[model samples]
Target chain A: MEKIKSIIEVKNLNKSFGSNHVLRDFSMEVVPGESLVILGKSGSGKSVLIKCIINLIVPDSGEIYVLGQNIRELDQDQMDKLRAEVGFLFQSNALYDSMTVRQNLEFPLRRHWTKEMRDLNAQSAVKEALEDVGLGHTIDMMPAELSGGMRKRIALARTLILKPKVILYDEPTTGLDPITAREISELMLQVQEKYKASSIIISHDMNCIRMTSDRVIMLIDGRNYISDTYENLQNVPDPKVREFFD
Target chain B: MIHLIKIDSEFLREVGEIARFTGRFFSEVIKPKQEWEEFINQCFWIGFKTLTLVGITAFIMGLVMTIQSRPTLLEFGAVSMLPAMVSVSLVREIAPVITALICAGKIGSGIGAELGSMRVTEQIDAMEVSGTNPFKYLVVSRVLASTLMVPLLSSLAIAISLYGGYLGVNIRGNVSWHLYWLQSFGALGYGDFIPSLIKTFFFGFAIGIVGCYKGYNSKKGTEGVGRSATSAVIVASLVVFIIDLIAVQVTDLLGLT
Candidate 1:
């Protein structure tokens, strides 16, 4: 991968729920237009790491910069502004089950987008994102009505509507069938390529890691098992790292 | 003896947990960016959804109270004062408090279980990772909604309950609708109504906060959701009564009676 300007900078991050320390002195940098796949076990704090950067879970102590904005220092209004620039694909599709696909996609855009932007254009953006994820026709359906794969696809579409500069995926393919997972990984790659947006995907799926990653790193034991390529990661002697692939 | 002591200890611990949870809710109320939407939704759910139930309950409560109190008033040859007594009782005390108690059961458990499941299932985490402020979106909205909505619901309940009392008065006596309302309002002053109305806000706040706290801080997965929901209603109901007692004492002390 070619070197690019850093889009997200995380430094000396530490978090604890009471005494159960989750992320300890973790640090990583993501470059503009890079697709960095984070590989970690369930409790290795993969979700927490991305959550901290996105200002979902504030770190007890650390510095986080997303697209050049220091998250910890930013106020609520600033954080809301920063959120509009970042998109997240939650692990469970978090599609507001009560709402239809069109409504789900419209939620963030409606809340954050200005009034001058036509509502029809917003709907079109949703349609385009859904079309990009191959769910263009399913927009009228509710999340509960969709299959697991379709739900994930709609979730991905919702993430796209914001036209975010930094997109985060939390276990994007955990529950999908192999074929569906592959399609999603492929879709993610397409998103990165098409939008030229930086993506940080948190997944334990080896195929997902290999297929979508321009750079891959493993979150292990509260620290990052930093590796630039999927090929280099096999050299990691840690049993957890080996088990991660096996 | 030892076994009995262990049972007593466990019961005490349960009570302690309830108190601590209730205290935490009060602590969090002043926090900012309260989820206004969730609160509004709760108001809609608790107050609006339960409208028919509250109306019927209040009506029956009033009817029953008037009928129940009529015998005593008649024994004293004060049967003519039945309308005035029922009105004051229903509006000033029974209506707001009873309406809130019902709300605590319905709204408190609903919020507790819903949020607890969300916590267990990681949907709340999903909200966070998506750059959505979970506290502001979930807690703030819900608590604010309950706080504002419960008072409004109580007002509705009070009115319905007075009407029920009227129906009860007319069941035997020839009290007209205007006469009943006038006598009810005459017996009830700002002193009676304000204290009771004020307590519903506390009741709403209690339900919202306890429910959210339990849900937000749920544990043990599926089973935890049930435990939190059940405990929320129980604790919130108890808190409503306790607050009502305090409000009564304070109002009486101030000679607002």
Candidate 2:
């Protein structure tokens, strides 16, 4: 039997802002087709850890490997090329407020797809991605016009349009109502099932974690404290870990 | 004394950062895959949007200069030289500076607020994560548009100001439209028009750079956006005056005065 290789790896990551240490020698991995949730209290450096993986925030000293390439070694153009294969869903949903839904979906395609390729299949691609998120009717609406949940779906559709090998979700359900949050969680599962793309979801929503996570990593005190299946972690006797379950 | 030194060092640091920002703009501007469509869109907004304000202010300036200077010229029995005097002043100094200052207020604050909010909202980060160069797409396009448009706006303002001068002349005395324009053009040489027009490009660049710098580095969310917009206007307006003063001195040194 062959061992599965990790698709994303972070080793000895450390980051600081002024005197505040956010992430300290933290590390984690996501294997192919895995939904790994980073569960932590607010301001426990979960967001910082994921951002370091994507190189949004430069870690003080660490190695981040994504799809067999060391990201820090890549130049701007090379990093851009690598970025096309990794989709990031911002916590704010970060849709271009000035652009309509169709244009927002097409923004990433502008960089990754050739004009001829886009002309040939861009419409259908946009349509299919929107349909995957059940937002086919919002093809022309401005982001400001959409409800919060609809905006989140549109943002997810934009992420899915690239058919990336990995997706990073930053607090996907932070501001949504419980129903909407569950819907987004379900959408995340559907996206994973449909695309088979591995994901690192940063969330404290236990329901979302239970529904979407194959495994959960407890990020505590700027480090990866523990990793286990959600149910197994719920039964752990460690008080710090039990604090989360309780 | 230590506190004073810290303040001085902080100011110098800001200056150095702005110089670095300007250097990045130059470096990125010449790279291939230029965002021409966005540049044109910015040109329309930065140029066409500010035309009305610039034109109105210029017309008022020319009219006021003509009406007030009438008494001075009449004392010297040179009231006939009113058109030439007004044209030279407008072409050499007034129109470009005033138009640029107006843009510093309107367009500068606008770009600052727009980019600042986008920064706060993480749109810029999203652009970068999407494999797009946000600086090249946003900063270069806006800077280039303002650099090109300010001079064009000044040129338009000069023409409008001259027309207002003509109207002012006719309000109290008789000067034919043809003669008013003829006298206005006759007093102007390459030296007056070219130097003033050249200065406006710097004015535009300063405004664009300052606006972009403040916005791109904004923090603390909405309050930061407001601060960026306010400071962009203040710094851009000051830079316009400084650039104008330098242009005047340089032109004088070159004997273009």
Candidate 3:
């Protein structure tokens, strides 16, 4: 039997801001179609780790390979081309406040899709993505008009419109109430099942972690302290790991 | 002494950052794949939106100048030169500077606040992650729009101001509309009009660039947005005056004064 290859590979990544180091010689990988969670407290560098993978924050030193290409070696145009294959859902949703829902969904298509492609299929694509997120009726509303949960769903819809091979989620349920949080978690599962897209979710919400994670990586003190299933992590005797389950 | 040195260095660092930001604008502006749609949108907002404020201020300026200058000219027995005096002053100096100052308050603060809020919300980061060049789309379009629009606004202000001067003359004297316009145009030469018009482009560029630079670099969230907007107006207004002073000197050197 052939072994499965990793979709994303980070090796000895290090990052620092002035005298404060955030990620230190940390490394991880995401296999195809896996939902891998980076679990840590706020300010524990989980967000920094994922941002480094997408090249949003340049690592001070190390290598990041996405889809088998070394990101540091790519030029701006090349990086942009690579970015089309990766979707990032920001914590704040980052929806363009100036645009309506349809326009917001179409914003990414403006650059990645050709005029002919858009003229032929853009409307259907927008509708399909919105339907996937259960937000088909919000096609004309402004982002400010949507409830918090709906805004998150619209943001996820925008991410799905590209049909990316990988999705990087930065705290998908941080501000939502528990009910809405679970809904978003279930939505994450549906996306994975429907699209078969691998994801790196940076989150600490145990409910979200347990529901969405195939495996969890414990990010502690700027390093990957352990990697295991959420159930396995719950049993780990290490006090550092036990603190979370306790 | 150490505290003074630190302050000086901090000031120098800010100047260097702004210079670097201005240089990046030139590099991105000349690149292909210009954002013409956003540019047109910005022109509509930066130009058309501020027309009322600039027009009203210019009319008042011309009317007040004409009315005030009457007594002085009467004492010199040169009250008949009112139209020429008012038109020359409006076309050569008052209209452009006042219009630019107004824009520095309105357009400059507006751009700063909008971009600063966007930055705080991570909308800029989202644009970059979507494979779009945010600088090219946002900064270049706004800067170019302001640079083009300020001169157009100033030209409009000059015309409206001359009309106000005509009205003022009619109030206290009997100069006909035709004769008033004739005297106004007769007093102006290429030197006065061209130099004044040329200076407004620099004024616009300064306002746009300063606003963009502050907003793009704003941090610490909402409070930082307020600071960016306030500083954009303050710095752009000062730069407008500085540019005006330099334009006058250059015009004098060219024997156009």
> How well does each candidate superpose onto the true structure, as a TM-score?
0.85, 0.97, 0.98
lDDT of 2 by residue, A1-246 (tens): 455498899999999999999888988889999999999999999888878877888889989999888999999989999899899999999999989999999999998899999999899999999999999999999999999999999999999999999999999999999999999999999999999999999999999999999999999988899999999998999999999889
- Per-residue lDDT of B117-198 in model 3, one digit per residue for the tens? 8899889988998999999999999999999999999999999999999888988899998999899999999999999989
Q: What is the Å distance of residue A29 in model 1 from its true position?
A: 2.7
Using DockQ as the yardstick, the better of models 2 and 3 is 2
Candidate 2 regions exceeding 4 Å error are A1-4, B1-3
The residue-by-residue lDDT of candidate 2 on B1-257, one tens digit each, is 99999999998998899999999999998889988989999999999999899889989988999999999999999999999999999999889888998999998999999999999999999999999899998899999999999999999999998888998999999999999989999999999989988999999999999999999888999999999999999999998998888999999999999
Better of 1 and 3 by TM-score: 3
| Cα lDDT over the full model 2 | 0.93
lDDT of 1 at A22: 84
Using TM-score as the measure, what is the rank order of every candidate, best first?
3, 2, 1
For candidate 3, write residues A1-246 as lDDT tens digits: 454488899999999989888898999999999999999989999888888888889999999999888999999999998888899999999999999999999999999999999999899999999999999999999999999999999999999898999999999999999999999999999999999999999998999999999999999999989999999999899999998888
Q: Stretches of candidate 3 above 4 Å error?
A: A1-4
TM-score of chain A of each: 0.94, 0.97, 0.98
Clashing pairs in 1: B34-B140, B34-B141, B35-B140, B35-B141, B36-B141, B38-B141, B38-B142, B39-B141, B39-B142, B39-B145
| Pairs of colliding residues, candidate 2 | none
Residue A229 of model 2, lDDT score? 99
**RMSD (Cα, Å) of model 3:** 1.6
